[model samples]
Target: MAKKVKVTDACQGCTLCTMTCPSVFAMNADNLAEAIVAEIPEGEEAAVEEAAANCPAGAIEIE
Candidate 1:
């Protein structure tokens, strides 16, 4: 099944998520990373999980 991901308020706008998974995460107007897709595409799950795991602020969440 597809998974959901989010950048929480703890996000630091470090651009890591955007860099790791541009297809699923992006920098919004405020520069904070936001999930571009409601649910992660089947192929993008690994990238999203990597972004979440590597997040320095522990801001990215996946469920």
Candidate 2:
């Protein structure tokens, strides 16, 4: 199943998520990361998980 990914308010605008998964994540005007797509793409699951794991603020959520 496709996972649902989100960047919560806990994000610190670190840009790590965006760099880790540029295809699915982007930095908003506030510089916080946001999921460009609601559903994680087929091969992008690992990338998303990596971003979440590497997030210093632990703001990325994958469901």
Per-model C-alpha lDDT, please?
A: 0.90, 0.92
Tens-digit lDDT string for candidate 2 (1-63): 898999899999989888888999999888778999999999998999999999999999999
Weakest 10 consecutive residues of candidate 2 by summed lDDT: 25-34
The TM-scores of all predictions, comma-separated, are: 0.94, 0.96
Instruction: Report clash pairs, candidate 1.
Output: none
Using TM-score as the measure, the top candidate is: 2
Candidate 2 ranges beyond 4 A from true positions: none
Give me the candidate number with maximum lDDT.
2
lDDT of 1 by residue, 5-55 (tens): 888999999998899999998999998889888899988888998999999
User: Which TM-score value belongs to model 2?
Assistant: 0.96
Error at 3, model 2, angstroms: 0.8
lDDT of candidate 1 at residue 32, scale 0 to 100: 89
